[model samples]
Target: MGSKLSYYMKILLGIIMSILLYGVVVYAQSDALGHEKWEYVLEDSGDILQIAIPVSAGLITLLKEDYKGTKSLALSYGTTLALSYTFKHITKLKRPEGRNRFDSFPSAHTSSAFSGASFLQRRYGWNYGWPAYLLATIVAVSRTEGPDGYHTVWDVLGGAAMGIGSTYLFTKPYENPKLEFGLSVNRSSRILTIRYIL
Candidate 1:
């Protein structure tokens, strides 16, 4: 029960932080456009790295045969995508410039990347989480660079916050009945028994 409560509390915190971040980004958008470097190499590298999130998740799930983890990741991904697109339409903010100038409030790539990273962190541990997050950050930075300059820093930040928040809200704790285990001992008889719930 305590663990469940803690989990919900964390989700709530993520939601609050996302909302706060949205407000901050809206206010900071005016000053967020001049930081782009127009480096094609970095942008291309980030685009490639962005694919690692889903690939890594899939590899981990397959290697460990963790169906529950896969399901959690799917839920996180769906939720993040849905929310990101919904907000983009609702906000109706324009992109930095160029042909794709509309629906640029929240970057879908950044959100997807962050959602995958957040799911890995919440479901697994920081060992996998931190690296995933770093890659996600690179993806976000990539969105702000390049000739097109797809999004502003504010957009990337908002997307990241939303992605993390959505993942936290949607991904539930893993529960595998077949994997349950218990140990018991009979002191008087000097007997020890290990039990598998399945």
Candidate 2:
């Protein structure tokens, strides 16, 4: 039941991601809601996703009682942030809007979002990763979108690479303990068995 439920949830996330992708394609074609309003919506959604993705990944591990996974997630995410900020300090690049003095080399929001996406994929599978990657891509685009967009293409790409690299450093694949049925026959007897892992 647990494995089944997890697979179902992954499917749902994939569905939701498809809808979001469709929305982006559709909305980009029309300015019916005006640029400011739609741009704000994208910006706000990106802000939420930057944190929400990693938090959601953590919750999944916690629900499965995977303390090791939780610890690894923290380590990976912390490293991503540390690396991102370190680059920010070292490069001291200005934002597209020139709003900040020097904190725009690698988009932290993109990094955070990608950390979750890559962690889930690397630790679980593509069934969990594909949708996450799509959502993270949206976060990256949002950072470079709108009249007040913050980062550049290079910034988002660098952030994405940083986040993924960190997760790969610490995360491991998770084996699903799905219930399976088996039949065995011996010289004296035949038997049916059910198997699963805790």
Candidate 3:
């Protein structure tokens, strides 16, 4: 019964965080474009990073015989991609450059990178999360540099929220165990650890 309660609490907390993150994303949209003058840089490198890194990571994890880790990574990446594409289509907000008539409400590349980062954090530790997030940040910046205004700051935030939220919601048990819990993120070491009373 305690485990069940813990599960519920974890889910509840995740929900709350999702809501707050969403709120922040919504609030950030107003000034996203005002901060900088737009420029164009077609650094198609994002595609390579997006596909190659995750696949290689996932493959490495699998090679190491970590099925759970592989599954978790796959799920996070797949869900983020689905969410990003769906959101783009649904919102149809249009990029700043007007090249694509899609919604600029959320950034797919950022979300993908975030999902990858979130998965690494959950399985490996914070040591991986920081670099992943830093890479995600670069991906977000790249979008802005492309003159497409393809994304606003809010969009990047939203992408991050989706990336992390989806993982939290899906990876956690439907019900939790009862007891004390702890969470940690190692910025430099790229490690994440969660300890709970069983």
Candidate 4:
């Protein structure tokens, strides 16, 4: 119980720190075009990439017969999406330059992307995880790039916090029963046999 409590406390602390860090970044920089310089062929593909993470995870889970992983991913993704939209509506914050007046407090793309990345990392390990994280970072950065930027740094930070927090809250380690192996020898017939139990 104490460990669980500590885990949640750490997640909360992380969220608070991220928000504070975002505040510092906002205060330290006066330039509104900080992220505008990054323009490339993949810039417009952020949304597609973000959505692909979960879809790919789901497909892989299904193919690999990972029912628990699939369920955990679904729960985490759904909860993150719900929380993000709820905050967006409640805050009613406008996008940069008043492009959109509602649903702008949290960047949904960043949240979703991060949620998928977190899920992959938590379940699979670093090999599959690091690339997902890198992609998620790209999605977050893309949200704030160019003259038509949709989200501010604060919004992206909030989304990231929500994504990481949600995944940590919902996903659990999967445990599989260990296989038992044994060897038996019969003296009468001098026969050897191997036994395996699942």
The candidate maximizing TM-score is 2
* RMSD (Å) per prediction: 10.4, 4.4, 15.5, 10.6
| lDDT for model 4 | 0.72
Tens digits of per-residue lDDT, candidate 2, 16-102, equal 566566656665653554464556667877888899889988988888777888999999999999999999999999888768567
Q: Which ten residues in a row have the lowest lDDT in candidate 3?
A: 35-44
**Residue-wise C-alpha lDDT for candidate 3, range 1-198, written one tens digit per residue:** 333433443454355345444544554433355532213212243444455446644764665566766777777778888888898888877777667566786888778767766665565555444555555565666666543456778887888788877766545321223455455557655554555643
> lDDT of all the models against the reference?
0.70, 0.85, 0.60, 0.72
User: Candidate 1 — worst ten consecutive residues by lDDT sum?
Assistant: 29-38
Q: lDDT rank, highest first?
A: 2, 4, 1, 3
Per-model TM-score, in order, reads: 0.70, 0.78, 0.60, 0.70
Best by lDDT: 2
- Which of the two candidates, 1 or 2, achieves a greater TM-score against the reference? 2
**Candidate 4 residue pairs in clash (backbone atoms < 3 Å):** none
Which stretches in model 3 have alpha-carbon errors above 4 Å? Answer: 1-42, 172-198
